[model samples]
Target: MLDARAHPSCISVAVSRAVGEAYAARNAAAQINCSETCFVLAFVPGDLDGRRVAAALEEALEGVPVFGCSSAGQITPHGYETDALLLLAFPKAHFRCSSILFEPLKPLSTTAIATAAQRHEKTFSHTAGWHRLGLIFADGLSKQEDVLISTLETVLDDLPLFGGSAGDALRFEDTYVLHQGRCYGNAATLLLLETDLPFRGFGFDHFLPGGTPIVITGADPDERKVFEINGAPAAQEYARLVGCAVADLSPQIFAENPLLIEYKDRHYVRAISDAGEDDALSFLAAIDDGLIMTLGQGQEIIRTLQSGLDIHDEQGRRPDFILGFDCVLRKLEIEQKQLGRAVSEVLCSAHVVGFNTYGEQHCGVHMNQTLVGVAFFGPDQRTLY
Candidate 1:
């Protein structure tokens, strides 16, 4: 068990590897001061029972609102952790939050979502001088992020949003997001937060467009599956382009060589999740017929990651902490290159906390194979609320 208390900072983090939900919750709760917290965020291991963990946390915190979801893995104080339950406590002194839950994301009603979000934004009283931002946790397997994020962005204009799709490790099966002490699948939650601290939102990847542009000839946009690329079977063409047999294709290879799409003169990674039936390729982000993409060439992972997290303000002050949403595909590539320890050291040095995600959301777009986060810096001049 690792417990970290950030004195003079408003956020407290606790991590526990205890066997059962009760023990884990108790162990984590003992490290935080519930009285000082407005709410708690819990990242439960995908392998653990989220319902039991919810119950245990409810009992442990005694009514402090808890919201979060299952994760592929966790970023604790000690770095990447797989089997631990992690909790982040946001103190009432520095932060205030209001959350909205959207269920049945499959039959996603865009108009309804927009109206509800607009209403929530209008009704939630905002502080005069505090910084406001949005955080979303959605069911990763629902395949609904592309539309959901776009809708929220339209309605909640000017409010910066950064979020992650809830993951169930590598199972690629069921995933859940917790709200009001219950775990809900096929659902999403949005937390609108106001904080007095200075902060910045960022997203970065180590890839650049390298190969000839390939067109997606046939695809199922709703399912995020590509049946054909460059007029050939998706998987077969991908393998040929990468100089490997179809059978030699795997997650590691896909991570090493990803697809990049150019939008607004900027390139973004479109990661592959799996090679499926009938030579189809499954993507982590949205896909469509006639969309153009190119193979991405990677740079030094450690250097790029370090440069990405080496953020500082004009005053030369680093962030007190960062809430990060890192793609699991990136994690796979890092492990394949034997850079886990080095990456973890960088994460620890930067004070990053959060989880590995199936997909990441930033700048009004759903992306993959990228790290998106918000870094919170301590207030230079303290002011009374």
Candidate 2:
């Protein structure tokens, strides 16, 4: 999809994965004269090389900044896809972006992160009608997202933040975040956005508590590993509650039935991503020993998505495009229920561009099984326009 507006900074999206046709991806980005292009790549074991792909894109786009990372699945105008590449080009006229990279992420002190955030904040001129947002891309395997987001939030104060965890498909092995032409592991990159457009940041999950509370009796808070729930083995107990055996529990099962934790009066999903040999359950978000979690049921996804997007549409002005970070677990649920077509229709109609993530970050908290995004309205909607 391409925006044909007369504005200087229009956007366009392209996707491809033809065998032996590697250059097609980079060429796609060059065709659209964007100042910066973000690329989401498919996770194929040894077949994909980050350095080579980055070089090709750099050579093709010349001086344009290239960013993004590997994804569990690519989200495009056509629908959800695997083994494909997707790119989004941001025009230079309306959008200005600056980024910071935090490496060896786990040991970075909150003070260091906060300092970096404060420095980024100082670069922007806070005009009355201008909107600014922070876009983050982190390693899904780092396990440092919780603290990093918290510290950054403290420094950002009121500047809205939204983003996703980079994934290597479902491999759960290694994930990389792209900056310029290099890939960084155990790291995170933040993009500071400045635009003169009406925009809103929002997040949603199509699930509600089922009223059955499961108490975490024992857990490894540091690793998000639950050893016991209600005095029984975590995996065994969860399977029993879901009407399935421990061995039968899979991503599909976990997607249909998830756990939700209420924080500050808002509910967030604590999705189970894997089961250990000792019958322990590992969650996507941080899990503690004393927290009480409720089993959640999936709602009508299409309606929920539409209603959530509608909340951002004000004064009859709809979003021109949305930069979304959707959870992969949600994709599994939609596919398992044969709702791919319907879900794709909604995503396309809403002009969503992004990828399925390992997790989502919003308002300083790392969450699971949710869709977080920033919707940008057309320039004409702004007061200055």
Candidate 3:
């Protein structure tokens, strides 16, 4: 277990399962002494016991607005972890957070989301010289993130949105978002934060395109599936290029190698979810016919990740805290390459507070295998490591 208090307004803790849930929640909240706390918790398959965690945290937080979600893996100040609970506390002195729970997200309308954003902004726009950003946690299984994020963008209007889809430890059965103390599946929780700090929102992946280029010829945009690449079966062609048989296509292969799509002269990763029995490929983000894709080659991950983090340092300010939504596939790539410690060191040095997500939301688009986050820089604070 690790506890870190970065500033008078922010603190973080990683609690192990060995500690009783109630004791851990109460003690961690008290130690941080913040009004807005986000907790990332471990999910036990078929347990569906969010009530236990919610009740305990609520008892400790004492009506302070608490929000979070289940995670595939939690990131703390120390490193990556499983079967642990991580909490990030943001005190009212430097930060103000307001959340709205959209229950039954399937039926979520754009107007309702916009109204929520407007309402939240009106309530808290009294503060000045503070940066604003949105943090979102949605049910990963609901498949409604694309619409919800875009709708909220209309209201946020360049305020910048960054976050992730909540995961249930790879179970893929059900995932939930937490608001206050209740767990809601098929729901989304949106938090609008006003921080008295110089903030920058960023998204990046550590992969570069290679010479291999493929084009989507047949697809189901709604389902995010591509059946043909360059008029050939997606699985077969992808496997051929990656030096594997179609039958051997797996998530691990997709993680080690990704497909890239060019947007405005830069390439963004389009990760594969899995290969289908029909030789189709499902992507984490939406894909449509006529989109050209190029195979990507990964860089030295540790160096690439550090370079990404170093961007803030190059800008004459380093982040005091970074609320990151890291893709689970990236985490898989780190484990496959045995670079966990190095990557964790970078995240720890950057003071990242977040969890591994099934998919990440950046700006207004839902993308795969990307680390999207908001870096908070205070005039009085600097990098710790």
List, residue by residue over 316-380, the lDDT tens digit for candidate 3.
Answer: 76677777888888988898879898888788877777788878887678777888877777655
How does model 2 score by TM-score? 0.91
Best of the two (1, 3) by TM-score: 1
Alpha-carbon RMSD to native, per candidate:
2.4, 3.3, 3.6
lDDT of 3: 0.74
- In candidate 2 the C-alpha lDDT for residue 368 amounts to 93
What TM-score does each of the candidates earn?
0.96, 0.91, 0.87
Task: Name the TM-score of candidate 1.
Answer: 0.96
Candidate 2 local lDDT, 1-385, one digit each (tens)? 4323312234666665644324754656555664444332223212356556666666766657777877888777666776666777776656777778888787667888898779878976675656788888888888888888888888898778888998876778868787876778888888887777777788999999996688999999778899999999999999999999888999899988899999889999988988989999988888898899999988998889788767445477667877889999999899988988888777877778788888899988999999998878878565211
Best TM-score among the predictions, by candidate number:
1
User: What's the distance in Å from true for residue 255, model 3?
Assistant: 0.6
User: What local distance difference test score does each model get?
Assistant: 0.89, 0.77, 0.74
Model 3's number of clashes is 0
